[model samples]
Target: MVRLPTVVIIGAGNLAYHLALNIHQSQVKLLQVYNRSRRGLSKIKKNTGVETSSSLNKLNRGADIYIIAVSDDAIRETASAITHLISKDAIIAHTSGSVSIDVLNNLRAELCYGAFYPLQSFKKERDIDLRKVPIFLSSHQPKTLKQLSVVAREISDKVVIIPDEERSKLHIPAVYVNNFVNHMYTIASDYCTKENLQIDHLYPLMKETLERIFDNNKPQDMQTGPAIRGDKATIRNHKKLLKDHPDQLPLYHYLTKAITRYYDENN
Candidate 1:
């Protein structure tokens, strides 16, 4: 980070793919990219114009920073694989939200290890503005954390040094907001399809739901539903509508009951 860091991204999956593009756009020296196979490497090389390789043994040594952007489960193995290639003091890190930075340290005790997690789900086909994405960084060593902050600031204005415990806790709400919420969208889409309705009809509602968050509206305060209104007839109707669709019935009942509990307490 202090030296206008050079990067060698070690993975060709979605996170690595987008990271390469954004890092390339950041104007950092992306020295090389490596994957275990040639499958996704070609598209990355073609897109970012960075050299790509499939051999870990052939990974260029002495880069300022090596980004281990591989999958979470593969982190330990990947870090072990590159231990021999990097210098004793080389900076190496991963982009996993669930995995700890110590996983890298455990593999290569001589080198420096850190976390370079972007707190957003990445899709290769979809472009993201990294400037708006909050980047959480952590390292066992303060020096490494400082260096990571420097690199993170170069790519994103929103950077923070979050410890592993806090980072893990932070990912919980991320799941509620992103993963679980997306599943709710899936259910809504399926229900629409079952009812012979176009899912496009829900897009505006979806947009407004997100916009309300940015407008600083608390979801509880904005709540509007039969449960909140204590309209038993309307809630029973919704339950009846979904009863035939066994899979969605339970979810509908659960959410209604949960919302009702909130108002029940207030009353």
Candidate 2:
């Protein structure tokens, strides 16, 4: 029988919670989960039936891999604290898209370190099928990269070997697509609430927007609406409608101008 890698997860945020559950369900042996507080640990422990630790010193040193699935700011500090506690042969990795792997490598020169970033926004309350999510792996060492790939493949089918520089660059568009787009939805929902309109009415349009992109249609080619059509009259009317929402007016103006400028320059 082939032996699966033993794992230890640090931090119990959204990503950590999901990773723990996925790893537990996988062939990997999840030894323990550690968080500074007990807030999120209980849920992870109860679901995964894995040991939980609040202290870094109490981490399982025998685990083959230690994944620091914490916030971007806390990754370095968390890795630094567990530098001496982890096994020398253990592979240390962080689950961050923007952060470089040097954050872990600089702390533990002897142990192999890399990144196991899942390019998906996680919410602890919602369950996600990680097999569909793309996981990006990076490491300076060839052997370490291979090892990380083995673990990554167990949880996700789409595993890509993306270096730090390229991964950081990808994060920019990721934020634009996910975060910025979600903020737009929030604004639109707020507008609907103010007007006493059903936000659900816009769901079909929103769904079609995503469907076009997934169908290999170019966003620029699919661009429609008053801004792209250069309909100044409709634009003026839309601006007038936003008179009651002073804060939202600037964003609406900026986006309209941006869209207009892009199409104009291309045409």
lDDT of each: 0.86, 0.91
lDDT of 2 by residue, 204-261 (tens): 9999999999999999999999999889999999999999999899999999999999
Local lDDT at 204 for model 1: 94
State which candidate has the highest lDDT: 2
lDDT of 1 by residue, 1-267 (tens): 446778889999998998888888886788899999997899999998999999876898978788899888998898888878887767888988878777876675558888999999898889888888999998888877877777788789899889887887888899999999999999988888888999998899899999998899998788886888889999888888877799988888888899989888876
Candidate 1, residue 5: Cα displacement in angstroms equals 1.8
Clashing pairs in 2: none
Candidate 2 C-alpha error for residue 48, in Å:
1.1
Q: TM-scores across all candidates?
A: 0.93, 0.97
Q: How much does candidate 2 score in TM-score?
A: 0.97
Compute the lDDT for candidate 1: 0.86
